[model samples]
Target: MSQIFDFSGNEEFYHGGSIYSNPKEAGSFLSLGIVNHVDVYFPNKRARISAPLVPGGESLEQKKQVSLDVLPDECLYEILRRLPGDQERSSCASVSKRWLMLLSSIPSADLCNKFEVVAEEGDEIESDGFLTRSLEGKKATDVRLAAIAVGSGGRGGLGKLTIRGSNSVRGVTDLGLKAVARCCPSLKSVSLWNVSSVGDEGLVEIANGCHRLEKLDLCNCPSITNKALFAIAKNCPTLTSLSIEGCQYIGNEGVQAIGQFCPNLKSVTIKDCPLVGDQGVASLMSSASFVLTKLKLQGLNVTDLSLAVIGHYGKTVTDLVLANLQNVNEKGFWVMGNAQGLQHLRSFTISSCRGVTDVAVEAVGKGCPNLKQFVLKKCAFMSDNGLMSFAKAARSLESLQIEECHRITQIGFFGLLLNCGPKLKALTMSSCFGFKDMILGFPLPNKSAPLRSVTVSNCPGLGDMTLAMLAKLCPQLQCVNFHGLPYITDAGLLSLIESCDAGAGLVKVGLSGCVNVTDNVVIALAKYHGGTLEVLNLEGCGKVTDAGLVAIADDCLVLNELDVSKCAITDFGVATLARSKQLSLQILSLSGCSMLSDKCLPFLVKLGQSLMGMNLQNCNSISSSVIDMLVGRLFRCDILS
Candidate 1:
């Protein structure tokens, strides 16, 4: 017989054999039998000559436990790369020490195409840059990070590695940072919040090792000084966005270096760095190749000189935040007003800039035509004159946060709201004592009141009528916070919930200091809108007792956060939350609840890992022993005392 099978089929080749058990058609398997020739084919690939097969003599269980040495390394890698997450890959590595070693030898980047991968769902909020990984708390330790670097041989295509500060991250040091720099050559972004151990030297190591770094966030890393900035200016030319918040030592020299080297820099945020004066800022702006866009300078020492430079060269700027720059007087804003470049400004936030008066504000208002967001915090000097111009010019406004702006009265403030029409979506006027009932009394277009969130906390002048009007006007409001409005009673709460689509849309409701709010409103919420209510805060409402809490515990299964702090609730009220199987509560604040004790701990312990935050501050009856035991059980919860 010929060595090659001469049998032919439509687009199929056969594996031929001199002696065969059973002769079969192209693609089907041939059984073992006495025959002259055997022919078999595979669907996708060309067929080869038949060879004697050896059946696995091992048991089925033994085969599963066997090492992957039988398969080629490439084949094993190909299979492992398809896993969904790191946890799944870790699971595969747990089969044996050999498997573990094999996986450890390969870079995680090679196993997955994505350079950076967020480990959890919440990480999306913090994810920034080309490759960003944000793992909140101490889920990722320095030791673990170092091990990953060593296992992957530093060739991991990771761009960003963000480990948010928590209790465990305090132990991380330069040793771990050095390991990462030595291995991961593709690292572009690194955010180590509160990692004080990493000094200028470690930063230098990163700057030298990863030159492609574009975005860097070193929040609260106090140890890093100007040396780190100098190194970055020399090495990192592609740097664009940089946040050196609370790094007190780096000043003018560092800022000057950034100006000289990083010509492509777009956004630069520096908080609490008083040494960076106008000279440093001017040098940075003078040499910039591209238009400067975003700049956030928040600190007591940031002066008018820097502000003047911003107004002079900040024409291309879209988002401007000059927060906490107390030294920036009305004169600095005058410079910005004259700068015709600020005409295209979209978002303007001058928070805690106490010197900002109506004179400078009025100029900015007249110039900036496309202002989408305007936030004025602690700018008490700004009066109706500035607001009138701002509101008239900024008809495209969507969000307004006027916290601590006492000078802005109903007329001045409403001037902006009146022109907002349907464009307004969020309104936060906390501590604006000027707010009165009439501010919200005016009729708003039901379809045009596109307001999704309304927070008017500490505005004591507002009453039940305002709340009722808000609900009636904005039926789709998802969050309503009128915390310090004492006059908002049960009638308003019920009317608000009933008139609005609270059952379907309202997720957060805050009546924190409404002393008159009672069980009637609480029971109404559970009966009518418990399903959509995720966070319900009745803090300081002394009238809400066990009956109100019990109603919520029984009906609101989806309540993730509940605050009844300073309320007249005892262990019975706290116990109701722990006993409820349906309520997988994440945050429970019982601060100042004098009657709460050890009796409630057992039920709370049942929540296990579900609880994220628990405030038991000033609970005189709850002894230290109960707290100790509770902390031991709920290790992850932020147990505040």
Candidate 2:
């Protein structure tokens, strides 16, 4: 019965006598990682006894299997507090009366991410800003505001509001924004996409009301201008982030107003505004007080002066994106190099600036210690020396894109991968003819890192083994685009699919101009990765026939976006796709498929409400009457013939 006895000293354990004698032998046997069962014996007396029952898994697991009778309310509350607010909390709240009672007692803020306001289908807000018509026919913003009004006073303690619209709902004019302004006072974030009618009057009202707004996105709202920006700065002083894209009338004045007023503005993205210029950028650098962490400006006419201002003031800038700054040269970049502010630069993108050369890039590489994304598109003067210098210096660079940079050779392009290949996640090199076969699949001495995305489209020198090598090395790749590689055959495509984790991870595969691709590669794709493939484009693959189409329809149940333009497929193949009940076919292109006729139209309507855009541009068989019929019947889907 001694507690401390080695196995060597215990003779009974050696002979399989009683296992309960020495506790040390039993503890040692149990410590050997036994899971299912353990054996301990007594030779003199034979007996069959059941072992102690182990605790079960976490399907409602808590202290003693989550029994309400066994645990106190405090312990139950603590366990529920650890559960995630969304699904786990909801599931626990639904389990029993006791759980429901406890969940009701917890504070709503701790139990939820954000109180959401979503307008139900067929629910409409009346012109007078009242809820009516199932809340469907009214403008999306109005209905959301009405929901906030009806829920818990105005605003309903709402933190996030999303008002998405279509043709059925009325356009979001000034009235809708005013409704949101009146109802949602605590709004912190708002996303307005596809609404063109929202102008300065409505935005001014929103700015006047939503003082606590931290994030505002006016993407595709082109009508707003300087007055609205001035109003926003005056009202929303706490605004930390703002995005204004595709706003036509917004110019230097609005940028100046935003910079002068919003002191806490940490991030600003002004893209596609042709009117913004160097003056606006200079004012921004001067008045914003250089507290910006992210800044993206496009379509701005700026010279070396703008770059100098940015380098001088933007010490805390992490992402600096400037496009169409044509006059910037080596001197501007050299001035920026001395700023010491760029030491924390993460993303540096300068496109359409042909004046930038290797000197600018070297200057940037020396200062940007944590540079992750380096993109220089249409920078004609950039060469191999500049690229290698940046690549060698910025050790954390994960993405490298060099488009239309004609001076880069294999030494620069491949040398980048040779040094930074282990950490590179995305590599896009297009129109670079100097990139050839040997560099792509060349073996590295160390373990290869998996790239998430790779686009070598229009690079003619790429050989057949390049894809196979990528298949072996980059298994996590989601998008592989070799759009104009005419010589690619089943060898590369098949190796790509088969080598992946059964090809289930691939999301988008583009082989548009791959003339040699045939049904064999498609069949391999359908066999392995049918469930996960989303966008499959074989636009110019002339060899794929009806058999391949049917195979894709049968296997690729989740495939929605497909383009078989100029392929060898006929009406019979398309009819098979039309009959597929599981596939949610959305954007389809049958352009240049000479064999497809009007018979395919009836089959296409079977897609019901899901089909959005259908292009039949070059099909000679479809009549004008059929096109008219398509326009009439499929009002929701775009028809092009």
Candidate 3:
């Protein structure tokens, strides 16, 4: 055949039987012809025919089918690098001996994220063996050991270390942790979850040795006392963030030490630390006045006596959380009420404080004029008068949460909404009897001040009219949560989804307790903004099914966190969510999804690398095998019982 020929001169490609005259088309046509001939000749070895075989140093262009053997080392390395993580890399190694050899030769730093030492159950020498192995294999020295002892005759590592343990490791004493800390010199972040054995001594060792430590999470570590704070303040002068939530032994003294010594501290959280009183918090605020910007003091024993002390020194705080301050009364509020320098404060949460009346609530609005986020839940005494105060004072407020407040009636709520409509971007109103029918008829935000989110849960009075009104006024609303509104049906929810401005911004939604809502509403949401929705809490909702979940998983690319706990979803829905190829999901809660079984757990294992939190509490079908696989895959995840 001629290499080059005009259409008029040659009929080889047109009239001839073969389509191999042109080079580009010839290669593809020849490949197809060869594949067909191979399949016909070697029917039993058709699978083998698909596998490309080539000689060493041969180019990929020489083979009809692309051969893995001909790829350059650098090109193959790049291809392996593009795989998701080590799990995927390991699967690729099984393809052939070349891949397996290449993966084994690669450095641990390039092949692994971090050194992980996992101790088997009832293995006495497990800790020592793992530590010895880790010390022997040194590519880059940052190790994470789970449920393994690292000090006090256990095992020790010289590299940067992270020690995480469960309740099963009762022998993991403070001395054990201290031994590891004394051994390691390059530690940066120490996150201790549910490890009650660690006390002040162990923490002090970490503070002293890890001078460059930036993050310290001690959640549910109850034995951490004031002595730990002294050690931290004295040694880790560069500590920037510290969380001491659920540490029962820590008191005002520890906080005072942090205030006095940690000059560079920027964030501090003391959630559910009952011994940390108002005075201790006040001392911390006064000491770290210039540097502290993020402070969370939830469930502390702070009272009205310390309000003045906090207000004086905490004026510069940007993110402040004081939820469940049971002793916070009118007096304490008045002290903060009169603060003059709290204009910089942005986010504030003061929920579950029964002592705080409308007077105290009003004072905060007056005192912190620049406050943008305000969460006031179970504040029984807050009424229309307090709403008036907020309207008059806090014009910059954007997010407001007023749930379980019985005193706020429809008339007052409407009046307050009218004032906040211009500035409010997110609003949550729940369990209030007064705003029932009135909210349905009330006008909402203007074009200039469009609402982005609204959550109305357990509000029995809210009907179709109220939703229609909200849909009309807040055209830019991205999320609307109506958890317990029985009156709302598919019509109301459909209207809201359809009214989404340009169908781009609406992301999350909740109709959990809306008994009237059916599959129709769920389908509507899945059809509209399912691509962007990340959280869809349909707990106790009997309407949704596998069809709706499949629709959502297929459309939503960014859906990461989902809470379908207690819903009637079956294994079909669970399988769909677990097998999603989007790769963005990180948390899935199927606590009460009874129909889901162990069949879908393998998919969860495949998808578990990115997951950080998962809840499978009451899923009876899941056994120990699934748990083992999940634990192995999700190294840094928090899995609840």
Candidate 4:
């Protein structure tokens, strides 16, 4: 008899089998004394053949049947890569030793280039292995950045790393900047806010290594000096945007270096750099670095010479900010008036520049023909003449902010209200003491101005008449902020709330610090126009209580942000206020309110995942546990408490 051979369907090839058949096709009718199984038939005389009956036993069969191992490693790697985030991938890595080994071998996982470790309180520094892995014994010249949360995470292999913490990043003796200098061939952007320890050497190290760095924001990094800046000019040729906002040590040397090396520089913000002078600025402009489109020289000692340089070569400037440049005088304006190529200018902000008069501003108005935004704050010398000049030339203006310019009287702004040809969309004027009822008396357009939004805060002189006129004239007004407007009582707001819209579209109203505003107007607003009102800011309205809030909650289902901080409300009031079922509140600022501690927790927690931002600053009653409950692990909070 010929040796019987058992066949396996799963195998790609059969072992020691002369013929094969499936059981489903075979029938007992084909042969007697046989089950419904396959049988092989031979046409010629049978020949003797010797073969193993069951091949190489069960173990061989088991090994051959495992088809998962037969799939390509690349395919398996792709499958792993498709998983979301690290925690899920880490779980897959733990399934088996083979999976662990395979996952470890993946180049994407092996590189481990970007790691952010946010430290929780009581989490021991020794337990953080991620920092050790990132900083120790790695050779990656192409590595870009390794960001670690302050108060946690180690300074690892140092290619390019950003340390964000409450404490200053001191000399990296343990995991210091030397590691970055040694390993990182290129470092680009470094931001260290409130970091006190980073001195001149560490900054110099980054400047030397990161040749292609474009933006360097050292906000409040006070120890940085001209020496470090000199190194940056020598090493980083592509540096464009530099902000040393609070660095006191920077002087003329730093400015000269920026002019020489980074000729194509665009944006520069140097606030509170006391040593900067007109000569340094002149040197910067004379270096043929005319490509500067944005320049901010705040809190510097720049004078007429600096202004002349800017007018000569910086005609291509788009956004020029000279806030607190005390030395800029009326002569500077004459030079700026002759600027020929400043046609593309869009935004200009000059705040606290006491020397800037109507002359300089008028020159700016004339020179920059395409100006779209003009913000002049604390320019005490600015008057109606300057504002009229700006309004006449900047007919294409869209947004304007005039803050703390006490000299710009109501007559100045009335020019915009009456004769200005441009249609304004947004306007903000705060602390302008010259604002009076004359602004309201200005003749409205035959069809009213196309004003949509207006914010007039700390303008004490703007009386009720002005508010009424704003409501009547700006028919399309959708939002208004009348903060700290003491004279605007409920009478003005009543008119506004009643006539905001004939049927629909009135959305937001901010009446914070309006001392005379009462609950009657707010309640009336809630009852009549609740459907359209989305944001209501009644902060510091001492007279508003539960009655107004309950009415708002019951009526205005679309209310998203309700700033009733400093209002006279209890826990019950907060609960009643937040009871609106369809309210999708994203930001809630209840700062300075003593009643919103444990009282508002249950109601706030009911918001669940809908609330994204909340400000509980100065709220003395809120405990830490409430914060933990509201935020959980996914909280990205900005707390200054």
Using lDDT as the measure, the top candidate is: 1
**Residues 485-530, model 1: lDDT tens digits:** 8877888778888876744667888888889998888898887778
Model 2 TM-score, 2 decimals:
0.57
Clashing pairs in 1: 21-33, 154-183
Count: clashes, candidate 4:
6
Tens digits of per-residue lDDT for model 2 on 1-641?
Answer: 13312233324434444456885665555444342242222233322223343245222212222234344575566566555433555566567656655654454334323343347654532122222121222455443443343232222344565554423555556765665565445667666665666789878877876787777777676678888888888888888888888888888898888888889999988887778777988898788856788988776667677777888788778899977766677788877776666777788888887657888887777777778888888887888888877777777788988887878865676556555635678989888776556644455545454577788778776666667666766667777777788656899888888877754477777888888999998888777888888989999899989888888889997888899999998889988988777888889998999998888878767753688999889899988888888888998899887
Those runs of model 4 whose alpha carbons end farther than 4 Å from true positions after fitting are 1-176, 191-208, 217-228, 245-254, 288-290, 436-445, 502-504, 568-641
lDDT of each residue in 236-332, candidate 4, tens digit only: 8777777777777788888888879887678777778778788777777777347778888888888888877787777668888887777778888
Clashes of each: 2, 7, 1, 6
Best by TM-score: 4
Candidate 2 Cα deviation (angstroms), residue 163: 21
Name model 2 segments beyond 4 Å from true.
Answer: 1-261, 267-287, 296-309, 334-338, 421-423, 433-443, 460-465, 578-584, 605-613, 624-641
A best-first ranking of the candidates according to their lDDT comes to 1, 2, 3, 4
Write down the TM-score of every candidate.
Answer: 0.61, 0.57, 0.58, 0.66
